[model samples]
Target: MASNIPKFRFLTAAQVRRLHGTLIANAQPTQPALLESAVQSPLNIKYYNNEQNLFQLAASLPEKIMKNHAYQDGNKRTALVAADMFLKINGYKLQETPLQTGNVSQDLENAHVAVCTNAWTAEELGRFYEQSAKAIEEWTPEILAYRNEATEY
Candidate 1:
């Protein structure tokens, strides 16, 4: 039997950043394209409709849209930005991503796909749009602190 769970791979902050930037750039043509391509694209719209599906797809590191770096210094930001745009285009409202400061850990072995070391997993990125979602609601402030502490290492 094959497992449906995507394998989790630890990534450097740079790698994650690159991934984020790529996704946003790839889907740049449409305003809120996540809705159109993800919802009305000629292929696989149903899967994009559910939260789990979005998580599975986002967690899958090998996805083309998830790995195409189109900008400097903001891959993860870009990915979330693109995801937000996609969702909005498809009729979903999302909150803006918080400010990011460089300071991720050099220890990539334990890294998870979160907005930052203290945020939720990249798979949970949709929570930003979910009603009453609190995972990353105030995480930017903590992340800023984390960045400060990280610089000393």
Candidate 2:
């Protein structure tokens, strides 16, 4: 079903490549098909194929990216960053407060492992994303920069 909500942003393959170069030391996909699959995950009908539910969108990245093995390495890192970036572009962010506990990197690591291994229920990967994603009223500056760059291409 189409959503009545306002439009949302999604990352392109080129943007993912740029992120890979900066954060993972590799800019190219080892398996181009897998990279495309991972990049297009949020649009899968099982994930609702719309902008109505942010959780569905946020939940799509780690599993596909981790399992797809798109790049030579750093798939887990890319999954985390991609999920966070997707959310930020759509007006949500992974926010942490002083009262929250546990190591975020560890949490993300555990979540990604659970996603790949199909033990997500035990690891509560949903909780990790749910706890972190907070919606805001304005577009993030990074997303604006991305919009500008996307237009230049």
Number of the top TM-score candidate? 2
Encode model 2's per-residue lDDT on 14-127: one tens digit a residue. 777777777667568889889878877775633454444655666676667888998888888787777766766667766332112467666666777888888774226656
Candidate with top lDDT is 2
Q: How far is 152's C-alpha from truth in model 1 (Å)?
A: 48
Estimate the TM-score of every prediction.
0.31, 0.76
**Candidate 1: minimum summed lDDT over ten consecutive residues — where?**
103-112
Candidate 1's TM-score reads 0.31
lDDT of each: 0.34, 0.67
Which runs in model 2 stand beyond 4 Å of their true positions? Answer: 1-3, 46-51, 95-102, 121-124, 136-140, 147-153
Candidate 1 ranges with C-alpha deviation above 4 Å: 1-68, 96-123, 132-153
